[model samples]
Target: MADIDLDNMTLDELKKLQKSVNKAVDGYQDKQRKEALAAADAAAREKGFTLSELTGGQVKKTKAVSPPKYRHPENPEQTWTGRGRQPDWMKDALENGQSKEEFLIV
Candidate 1:
């Protein structure tokens, strides 16, 4: 590319140059983005999934909620999934000389 003598250019010429430069930059960035997306799609396809699925761009199918495994002894309304941290009610029961096994729904 030839050297652009901005010092010798008129105000109108400089404005045109700026516009052309901005357009070229935008086009280059758009091309790169498209190429990246294509690569990601190809990789996802190789893994038996789509780019949308990997990126969560499509509506996600939610998993079914698991049934409660443990129920509160005193309050039958309270229940625990038995996956994460113990519930406050169960903790209180244990602290008050109650066994966790006693609260088992079985």
Candidate 2:
């Protein structure tokens, strides 16, 4: 709150003032963040769920990927789960007049 003339300050004084300002700002932000988190946790608890569950803040557990359902006709080693993008071999097969039903595992 002190109105000191910054122009009259030495280089070291200005640097010290900058550090103090930065430290104060960091401390203020940390306090605010903590308060916000506490409020969120309280609100979540009131709604019968933890803050992590309410806001999805917890690390998600990955589900096991399903086994491949379809296989290549030419090469039995090549297979697909029919989930994501098609493989190059599958694309080539399709291009060469091969029906997708021909590659079914069952």
- Stretches > 4 Å off in candidate 1: 58-106
lDDT per residue (tens digit) for residues 1-106 in model 2: 7798999999999999999999999999989988988897888889899877865777344599999888987789989998899999889989999988888888
lDDT of 2 at 1: 75
Return the lDDT, model 2, position 51.
Answer: 78
Across 1-106, the per-residue lDDT of candidate 1 in tens digits comes to: 8988899999999999999999999999989988887897898999999978887887344599978888987689899988899999988888999987888887
TM-score of each: 0.53, 0.53
Clashes of each: 0, 0
Predicted structure 1: lDDT? 0.87
